[model samples]
Target: MTPTDPGQQGPLVEPVPGAPAAVATLHDERALVIADYHAGYEAGLRIERGVDVPSKAESRRERLLSLLERTSVGRLIVCGDLMHSIGDPGGAERGELEVLFESLPSKLSVTLVKGNHDGAIGAWLEGCEIVPGSGTRVADVGVCHGHTWPAREVLESRVVCLGHEHPCVRLEDEVGGSRVEPAWLRGRLEPAAFRGRDEYAGLEWLEGDPARTGSRPVESPAIVVLPAFNELVGGTWINVAGQSFLAPFLPAGIARGEAYLLDGTRLGPYRSV
Candidate 1:
């Protein structure tokens, strides 16, 4: 389960004395990037439909904090969608975020990149640093939430990290049983990469040769599609065949990328692509 690329170091998880697991970095120092937290999503669902799901925000926060403490990362960059509301922060969402933030060690710095779900949270996030879709460069890497392709100007950066569509892949055990696990996929963009591919046909914007004049390639920027930090359990699997919505997000023509299975104490990379 070691990575094929010698340059690719660290499984998704690494050990820290008091924390159960920490998301390791492929590149970067004193920084950790995570996406699609969707804070207060359950409460939002309840308000919208009166569904009765148990509140799990506190536990999720504890897990995130444990990772943060374990990594001892000086900075935490949320690619986008810190809250699940389309426009404004709901009472529950706000309260949960408040609790989560308050629980963080004062030594840590937090940054939020606005995703499609962060529409009106700006007012609520008065003093916190917020980056719009334009994105930010950290340790020579570009980061954004992957709801839409970045403008050509922004894509010029060397590495792009993002989140939005929570990416997962189904894995079959030795006995033929299956389970869905969160995955990280990486691919290199080539000319006309997704042409004729049914999974990517619907994404007309991604079909043509990126090198062609006026066609900007939406490549995976050392991209890291994080598991949903919230309790909701649906995601797009990159390993499946056919027209996957995630096809356009990865490097063109690659049906799947290497898989890093994250167990509580150990993270191992299994070559799947």
Candidate 2:
């Protein structure tokens, strides 16, 4: 639970312009947050898709370092997918992870919310805190990988930051060509969708009255679905017909979700955009 000292201000979550990252301001410290780093993605592409490509590991590390400097955050939170392999990470991936951590400022703390692709990561990575895939609270905000139902405590936050869907949208040009761009999905949580689920069993609402208003059963937290930090990864084309979400509880877990581009362009309703 977040502290409620009358003297301290609440945490604020703000996305970085033109980047797949956000800055979360806590009472005493700020955090740089991102999702789906997918380290060593090039090797995965070669093994799985047979597409040989050059590694962008150094570039990724540099970009993250730049964001850290720009945001001047004291901590870095990776929502999930810090690694690309589902099993043991390859040599390249491990090396990339090592160099990335070594490059960080000595005082900057790191947190990794375990994701589906992060099965093999553990204590070997120094200076990194690995939390459960369900989620964890940082002040008033909840951070999760979004592949499964979040823990009850996480659901109770004022806002929730999630990844794993790698949301994007298909845009069509006047010449009949189409391009896909990374997108952000913003919405409110639906208690009914998660109330009786395993992760949310025995949960109780402390705010709002659904019986009186005929609206949501409880006070819902704002949900922010972040875009993948690695531009090389494929994502769910949210507005395209027949393109479904990857998260198990998404589309149902979120209510009235609207899509936005990385540049902060609101595309209106995701279904109609």
Global lDDT scores for all candidate models? 0.60, 0.85
lDDT of 2 by residue, 1-273 (tens): 111111234436778888999887766788988999999999999999899999999999999999999989999999999999988988999999999999999999999999999986985667799999888999878999999888778887778898999999999889999999999888777666776567565555534567886877655677889999999998999898888778877888787888888788888889898
Clash pairs detected, candidate 2: none
- Residues 1-273, model 1: lDDT tens digits: 221122343343232323212333435555666777888888877888898788789888988987887677877778788888887787888888888888888877787888888897778664357988646765445667767654343344344556665756677888999987665544333325435545435443445455665767454323344555554846676566762554243444332345544432222232342
By TM-score, how accurate is candidate 1? 0.71
Segments of candidate 1 deviating more than 4 angstroms: 1-29, 151-154, 174-176, 190-221, 246-256, 264-273
Worst 10 residues of 1 by lDDT: 13-22
* TM-score per model over all chains: 0.71, 0.91
lDDT of 2 at 97: 95
Query: Candidate 2: where are CA atoms >4 Å away?
Result: 1-11, 201-218
